[model samples]
Structure formats: structure tokens, C-alpha cells
Target: MTRLLGGIGAQVLAVLAAVGRVAIFAAVTLRHLVTPPFYGREFLGALLNIGWLSLPVVGLTAVFTGGALALQIYAGGSRFDAEAVVPQIVAIGMVRELGPVLVGLMIAARVTSSIAAEIATMKVTEQIDALVTLSTHPMKYLTVPRVLAGLVTVPLLVGVGDIIGIFGGYQVAVRSLGFNPATYLQNTVDFLEPLDVLSSLVKGAAFGVIATLMGCYSGMNSGRGAQGVGAATKSSVEAASVLILAANFLLTGVFFSA
Candidate 1:
């Protein structure tokens, strides 16, 4: 009993310590975001990597998800003969929840793993130490640019995802579900409030920050060698995915509660 209790207590403390470290890391990243000696080239590269390169995956995910969502809503609504509500439901669902959440998860899967692996490999190669030797802050050069790129590009990605997702639903609804194309488009546009759009973009920014920060933090703190890099990559994605979901729930409550 004593050993079990002690083990549980140690795990809890470790988790809390990790949370504290991440919070401090995030604070430091944000502080550097506003300071001098910004790395424009690195920021642009990160922007391209995190945003442009991610479009195909984001689009594919959004379109398929939107189509499936439409189909599900149609089937469910059919029980009550409320099938006509598909457009509004899809719009609200995508803009308010599905679009941002799915995009965040996809980013976590793709970008987070890449960031962690790259940084960890750099660490293994001693490039981070080389930066220190050259009088450069590793966090400023690597972490800040990636974090800023995430902040700037993720909202754009979310907007694109929301549009593509709505289009996907429109295609399914009009083509297969017998919804009038014009009416469906109108309904989608009419049903979406400015706040819904705002919330989706806001969620995008928050999730992006979480995803990139997790990757950077894990990479920076990763242990030695291949095993360490692999572990860091896995842990980064896992942590980002979990945090994104948790943050989504909290943001949803804050935005829609009342």
C-alpha cells in the first residue's frame, strides 16, 4: 500500500512538473516573439512548412469529414423527417467545432512529429550547442519562429478548412441528398454567425500554439540519440493531440456557455 501510494504520488508530481515546464517554455517563446533579432527566413520557412505544405492533408481531411458529417446528419434527421436542416447543421458543426478540431489534430499528426524529429536530430548532431557557441539563442532561432509561424498560418489554415469542409458538405447534400444547390449554399451562409467564424479562427490559433510548442519543448528536452528522438516525436504528437482536445472543450464552454 505504501509503495503504491508513493508511486502514484511521484507520477502526479512528475505530470505537474511537466505542465509547469511547458507553461514556462510557452511564456519564454511568446516573450521572444516580440523581441529583437527576429529570424525572418526561418519564420517564412516554418510558415511554408506548417501552412502551405499542410494544405493538401487539411483539405482532404476536411472534405471527407464534411461529407461524412452531412451523411450522418441526414440519416439521423431522417428519423424525425428533419432532413432539410442538413445545411445549417453542417455549417455550424464545421465552423464551430469540426473544422478547427480536425485541422488541429491533422497538424499535430503531421507537423508536430516533423518538428520534434528535426529538432531532436539537430540536438543529437550538436547543432543546438553550436548555436550557443555562436552567441545565438537556440530557443529564439528555432522555437520562436516556429511558434510565430504557427500563430500566423494556422488561422488561415482553419479558414481554408472551414470553407473546403462546407463545400464538401454542399457537394454531398446537393448531389446525393436532393438538396437544392442554391438553397443549400444560402442556408450555409445564412446559418453561420460572425461569432462562429471568429471562434473557429480563435481555436485554430490556440491549437496551433499548443501543437508547435509541444513539439519544440519535447525536442529541446529530448534525451540522447535515436531512441530519444523517436520518443520525443511520439510524445510530442501525443501531448499535442490531447491538449488540443482538452483546449477545444474548454474554449467551447467559454464561448458558448451562457
Candidate 2:
């Protein structure tokens, strides 16, 4: 039992060490955030890559999720003869919780994994080393733009997703559920305050930072060759997903808790 306990302790220590390394990387990256000689080209490119290109997917995800959520709420609420609350509930839930969380998770799977794999491949090909030899800082050149883009892009994406999601729920409620169009919409608008939307944007921003940081960190730390790249890609996705979900809880507390 002592031996087993010792092994578990060692594993826990290793995990903590890895997390510490990520924290150090984050601190170093943040230090460059306020410095001059900004990489405008990279930042703009990242904005296009991470934000503009991501809209269709994010919008689609939000629409379907909101529609499904409304349906579920209607079904459950009907059991209590409270189906009238579907539109309002769906609106609040989508903007406050589902919108940001779903968009964050989707971006984690798509953007985070892709970023990690691309960077890992570059690392494997010695591209990162070449940048170093050329006096180009990998952290600034590679990580900074992606992180900045995430900070700017994700919140926008989440906001867009929230709008689309509410629309989706509204559509389903009016058409399939036979809800009065004006009544449904009025209820949705009545319940949604400025704070609900703003909280979602904040959640999006945090999720974006968390996702991009995980991707950059895993890529930089990836070991040699194909196996390492695969490992890094997998790790980035896993970390981003867990972080996004955990962040949702925290953000919800901050936004909704009395």
C-alpha cells in the first residue's frame, strides 16, 4: 500500500509540474502583451483565421443547440403545465449558459486541436528552431498572435452564437410549438437583460484565452516526431475542453449567483 501510495504521489507531482510549466509559459507570454513592436500582421491574420472563419460553424452549433434546448424545456415544462415559460427560459439559458459553453467547446475541438497540431508539426520540422536562429521569438511570433486573436475573436463568436441561438429557439417555438410569434419574442426580450449578454461575452473571452493558451503550450512542449505531435494535439483538446467546462461553472457563479 505504501508503494502504491508513493507511485500515486509521484504521478500527482508530475502533473503539478506540467501545470506549473504551463503557468510559466502563460506569464512569459503575458509579459510580451504590453510591449511595443506589435505583430499587427500576425494579429490580423489570426483574427481572420480564428474569428471570421469560425462563424459558420459557431452559428450552426448555436442554432441547433438552442432549438433542441427549447424543445427539451417545453417537454419538461409541459409536465408541470409550465410550457409557457419555454421561450423565456430558452432565451436566458442560451445566452447565459448554452451559447458560450457550446461555442467554447466546439472551438476547443476545432481550433485548439488544429492550432496544437499545426504548431507541433512546425516544431517537429524544426521551423520553431529556425525562427529562434533567425532572432525571431517563437513565443511572440507564434503564440502572441493566436492568443490575441482568441481574446478578440471568441467573444465575438460567442455573441454571434447567442443571437443565432435565441433566434433558433424562437423559430422552433413559433412554428413547431405553435407559440404566438409576438408573445414568444416579447417574453424572450423581457427576460434577457444587459447583464446576461455581457456575461456571455466575458465567458467567451476567458474561454478563448484558455483554449489558445492550452494549444500553444502543448505545441511548444510536444516531444519529437509524429507520436509527440499526436500526443500534443490530443492533450490540447482535452485540456481546453476541461478548462472550458470548468470555466462555465465559474462564470455562471459570477454572472448568476445572487
Winning candidate number (lDDT)? 1
TM-scores for all candidates?
0.99, 0.97
* Residue 193 displacement (Å), model 2: 1.4
Off by over 4 Å in 1: none
Model 2 backbone overlap count? 0
The TM-score obtained by model 1 is 0.99
lDDT of each: 0.96, 0.92
- Tell me the spans in candidate 2 whose CA falls farther than 4 Å from its real position: none
Candidate 1 residues 48-128, lDDT tens each? 999999999999999998999999999999999999999999999999999999999999999999999999999999999
